[model samples]
Every structure is written in structure tokens, then in C-alpha cells.
Target: MGKLLTLAKEIIFPSRTTCFICGREEIVGEDDLCDACRESIHLCICPPAPLPLDGVSAGLLYTKELHEPMHRFKYRDKVEYAAFFCQYMSIPQDWSIDILCPVPLYYLREMKRTYNQSELLARRISAIYQIPYCRDLLEKTRNTATQTRLNPAQRQRNVQNAFKAAPECKNLSVLLIDDVYTTGATLASCAKELKKQGASKVYALCACKTDN
Candidate 1:
């Protein structure tokens, strides 16, 4: 099914093209946090350690007040929110990221949502870094229950084999993007799949984490 859709897209548009916190309604160009919300938005940036996953960084910490905009970006389709990465990303200019990959959603779920939040984030980063953005490189093969509803162990089981890599990402170093990280189950599972497909290395980036 994913393949058929890919074929259809290839027959149609050949190329794929290219966040925000609180009180700031509109994020300025390439900025995740607006000036009015800068101080507080900085308050939401997540630290880079002990997050149950390594080599992943995020721009915000999901809080009660912070959830509104983040949730809007995710469940709704306010993708312009991804620009918030510009405010918080610290990727070295020489980091030499080979590819930009997004955490994938099960095919049916993506259709219903009309877009994958992570994919949109990746595209924005790809544009900024001038790297290759490959959406099809990781495909979600399952549509399990919401990850948020599952316990940690259950979440691990639910996402197993949920992702598979495309040939284009084989032997490439991929920086995977996601919306949030809670237990790291999803990141590990997706990275494992990319590694299985011969990815040289797999790193992760997300907008936020609950415990961060």
C-alpha cells in the first residue's frame, strides 16, 4: 500500500518540498520561539541528557502550558510550527548530516492526519542544512494504538517492526526527527530498523520530551 502510493506520487509530484510555544502566536522566519515568548520558550527547551535515548536533542519540554501549541502542531496541521527548530537547533555547520529522516506514522494514520509531524520537521531542517530529505526512507508498517496510551514496555512492543528503511538510506547516516520523546521506545525501534537496512549511523532529534 505504501509502495502503491509512492508510485502514484512519483507519477504526480516528483519532488517533496518543505514550532512554537505559547504566548507568541506567530513564529518569525526560521525561529521556533517568538521574541515575545523567548524568555519563556527558552524555559521549555529540553536538556540533552538522561532522556532514555542518546544522541537525540530537543527544542522544548512539554508542559501544561506548552502543550497547547505543540499539540496544535501535531494533531492539527499547523506545520509552520516546525520553524521553531531554527530557534533552538544547535547542529554544527560541519556536522555533515548525510540525510534527514523523519519518524514515520503507519500509512493509514498518516492519511487520516494528512501529514506526518516529524516529516514536516525534517523537511524544514533539510532546507536549512542543505541536506537530502528522504521521506520514503523510513516507512511505518503498523497502525497500533496510540503510543501515549501504552505503558513503557507495551510501547516498546507496539512499535517493534513499525519501521523499515528504503534503499536510498542504505549506508547513509541519518538524523531522525520526531515530535516528542517519552520512553525512547519509538526512537530505538526506528533506529534499529534503519540499522538493519545498513544505515551507517542513526541519530535522533525531536521537539520535546516529557521527562527532559
Candidate 2:
């Protein structure tokens, strides 16, 4: 009877779900992506080039295999993917950041999406590392155009003055979290505001970075 019940459950809920990237049902592990797709993911080997921010760390190189999963994580309602993605983020031992602050979304845009993807990643990191997560420390003062289509220079221009750091950030070291680091423009702008508000140092941690 137990075996029969288990079989019935799998039939009802479809225990074998397709991989997030390749759409293969023969997933080997509990992760959303199958074993073959997981093995194909190319992690970033070398650290990214220096940005305006003090330091930058990223997990994966933006590749064709990562595109669909990231799209589903950010735009689609695949919030559960945060755990899978967070596995790649590795915080440096020497940084000793005081707080984890996810890049904020404007109120209207956040309301439309129902949650900030970065915040989701930050919360997971906070829980894992026992660091305090401060959502209010930095905020998006204005809703700007998406950085998807912009060139590196234009990306900088688009996000200029877009973030406002709270005074409570004074003297605190911060680690900013984001879903992607395309041109480093968004992170640079955020770091600038944090520093202007008296943040001692700001570092960036991103789940993926474009390999330009």
C-alpha cells in the first residue's frame, strides 16, 4: 500500500520535473537543473576586472546555459531558484562586512514583481552566514530604465543618482548583493551613494557576471 501511494503521488504531482535550462526530465539530483546541465555550467574562474567599488565577487559567468535559468529566476515566478543560485556565491574570508544589502527596487516596480530577486538572494546569504540583512540601508529613489539593452557607458548614465543611501549606513562596511553584474554600472552607483553617506567600504557580490 505504501509503494502504491508513493506511485500515485508522483503521478498526481509529477515528481520528475524538467530541468530549468535544458528541459530534460531525467534530472539526477534534487536541484532544478539536471546533472548534465549542471555540469555544463561554467563558473567564473578569474576574478572580474576592478570596478569603481572596492571589490567584486561573482559566482557564474553569464553563458548561454545560464541565460534561461536567470531569466526564470528574475522575471518569471521561480523564487525557489534562489537556493540553487546562492550555492555559487562565495564571500571572502577577509572582507568582514557588517551588513548585507540587496540593491533596492523602486516601490512601484517592486510591487509589480511582488519581491526583489536580489533581496531573496541576500536573505539566503544572511541566513547562511549569520550576517545582518538591512533592506532599508539603501533604496532606489527613482525608477530607471532597465539596463538590459544599454551599452556600458549608457548603463552608467541610466543609473546615475538612482540610489539613495540612508544615514544609518555611516561608518558601516557593506556588501551589496545583486542578481547580475553586467557593466558594473549599477553596483558602482550604489557604492557611490553608500560612500557618500559615510559607509567606510563597499563591496559587491553578484550571482553572475557578463564575460565581456
Candidate 3:
């Protein structure tokens, strides 16, 4: 993200185009790449997983393209990068929800980052679908370590008891939001919390994910 753009800036001249991902000076479209490169990126479409806990929805596979913008959107505050969320989103036909929710982050991280990346994605979805945003319906109860650094079993255990839902949300279908999905343990924990809080239904949306 920032690193990509910073490098890109160094090469700027009168008229220059570069692949958004690899920066090959042969980009074809707006912040895009040539056909072979674009197709080679493996922009896969994942069949809707059965919510794993309840109703869920997601857009793109967290392949190479999605990783950078999502990273910049959070770490660099490039809010405009959020466009990539819906720029590639494929709304699930199964999803019909009243409100959108972000998988809550621990307060310390949110304060440190000054924004919740998941909530930012949620707002984009809400705006596009004309749905309501309920950003506060979920809360993080524990600050867990990065899920990727841990194995699958450890990831599951790490996210357990990490999330909770607000008491005010009842009879509501929650649409949980996050930047990416991997093992889904984090989402499962959040779903459990939403169920415990009396949410009639829970759905989720993320910018990208791998392995469907």
C-alpha cells in the first residue's frame, strides 16, 4: 500500500502506467494491469460458506490484489482505498439484513490504530446497499495476538471469549464486518457472542479471504 505508492511516486513522469500489484510499467486501466497479469492474479469467487455459525456474506477472495489496499486502508489511513471493498464485492443473494456490524476489535488496538478496519468495510457495504450501520452492536472482550502467527487450533483457542454483543441489539440480524477471513475462528467467536446477545440472525461481510 503505502510502500507501493511511495515507490510508484519515485517513477512518475509525464505519462506513466504500472501494474497496481507488481508495478510493471504496463498497466492498462485505472490502477489496473494488463490482461495477462490481471487474469493471472486468480481473482477467485468462493461459494457462500454456510455461515459456519449463522448467515454470512463475503465478496472477494483475499488474494494478492486485496491484501495491499486493505493493508493501506487500515495502517496508512488511505480511506479512499475502501473503494476496493465494493469495487470487487459480489453481494450474496442469501444476505438480506437490517443492520451491519463490525467484528469488534479490542479497545487498545482500536485506540492505537484510531480506527477499526472492519468497521470501515462495514460502512462501505452499508452505503452501497442502503442498509443501516450498527457499528456498536459488538465489542471485543479480550485482546488476542495476531491470528496468522498461530496455528489453526491455537487460532480457535485465541479468539474464544474475545467478543461480546450489546444488550440493546435484539431481534436484529447482524451483518458482521472484517477486512479478511482465514480460519474463521475470529468470526465464529463473534457469532457466538451475537447469538448470546439475542440476535435473531447474524451475517458477515469481509473485503477478502483465502480458501473460500
Candidate 4:
């Protein structure tokens, strides 16, 4: 009887998928995550110390196992992974956030990638939470070197003056969304611009964080 039910489920939902992290089929649970992969995820128990942004929150710790999925989502056209990643995100209950703003990509890079991964993640989060999201709230004015190889100071300098906030962001309390938070230089730079444009508060949220 159980085998018959399983077979019927498979036939009815042929597009039912595997775990996003391990690609394990037979995900007999919620959210397309296998038990092992779900158990292995290291969620942030405590939020990071405040930076230029009011606060920071992340869903998972950056681990070697997460590298491939993150890379594929960002650069390998695996946009479908956004839903899996967004499922783990948690917004602060105390934050009176008015909008969601994705950390923007420079035009050339965005064009080359065909889509901004951060925007995709942010939009999914916005849809889930029913919060308005604007991709144009922040704009990357210059193409900078990737932060992956940069030291803390270099990362700070690389993104400095790289972002500009739009007029529409003025006086809005925003939750800025991104894929990863490493040195936090990118988020800080963006926060500075948003504050300059009269945003009341800016909080950062990311899918993954590295120990720094």
C-alpha cells in the first residue's frame, strides 16, 4: 500500500525534485531539502555585531559544501536555486522594514550574467513576505574587482563609492538583501548611500555568511 501510494505520488507530481544542496532524489519532506543536507546546514544562532548597517542576518554559514551550490546559482544559470536558498531566511521581528532592496550589480556584469542573483533572491523573499522590493533602489555605479580574493581593507576600498541610492529610497526603512556576507564591505557601502539619500534605517540580510 505504501509503495503504491509512493508510485502514485511520483506519477502525479513527476516534476517533484531533489534536494537543492546534495541533489538527492526522494526528498520525502518539505522544502526540497533532504534530511542530511538540512541537518548539515549551520544556521546563525546570533546575529553579527552591527556594522554601518543597523543589523545583519544570515541563514547559513559559509562552508565548503555550500560553495558549489552558491557558485552555480550565481554564475551557472541555476536561478531555480533561489527558492531553496530563500526558504532558510528569517527576518527580524522587531525590524519595521518598509521595503526590500537587493544589492545591485553593475550594468555590464548584470548584462553578462543575464540576471542578478541577488535580485532573484530578494524578489523571492519579497514574494514570500509580501513586502515590496525595488531592484533600482540601489545602483552599482562602477565595476569593481570581485571580493572573493580581496583582503578586508581591499574589499572595503573596492566597493567604496561603488553604490548610489535612488531618490525613491529616501526616508524608507529598508532591508537590503544579498547572496553572501563576507567582509561586509559591499553592504556597508550600499548602506552609506541609502542613508545619504535619507533612508531612515538599513538592515542587511544575506543567504550565507563567512566567519570574519
Worst ten-residue run, lDDT, model 1?
15-24
Q: Model 1 compared with the native: what TM-score?
A: 0.76
TM-score of candidate 2 versus the correct structure, residues matched by position: 0.89
The top-ranked prediction according to TM-score is 4
Q: List the residue pairs that clash in candidate 1.
A: 19-81, 19-84, 32-84
How much lDDT does each candidate structure score? Answer: 0.72, 0.88, 0.72, 0.87
Please tell me which model should have the higher lDDT, number 1 or number 4. Answer: 4
lDDT per residue, candidate 3, 1-212, as tens digits?
A: 69778778756832447655554676366536565556745444555444445644456666665566567777888766667566665557776687888787789998988888877777888888888888788888878998878888999899888877898678887778877777778888887888888888777667777763
- The CA lDDT at 144 in model 1 is 76
Poorest stretch of ten by lDDT in candidate 3: 43-52
Which residue segments of model 1 deviate by more than 4 Å?
A: 1-37, 43-54, 92-95
Q: Residue 119 in model 4: shift from native, Å?
A: 0.6
lDDT of 1 at 122: 84
Per-residue C-alpha lDDT of model 4 across residues 1-212, encoded as one tens digit per residue: 69999889878885446777787675446767777777777886545645669988888888777898999999999999998788878898988889999999999999999999999989998988899999989999999999999898899999999999998988899999999988788999999999999999999889999855
Query: lDDT, candidate 2, residue 162?
Result: 97
Tens-digit lDDT track of model 1 for 151-188: 88898899888878786778788888888878788888
State candidate 4's TM-score.
0.89
Each model's number of backbone clashes? Answer: 3, 0, 1, 0
After TM-score superposition, what is the CA distance of residue 45 in candidate 4 from its true location, in Å?
Answer: 3.1
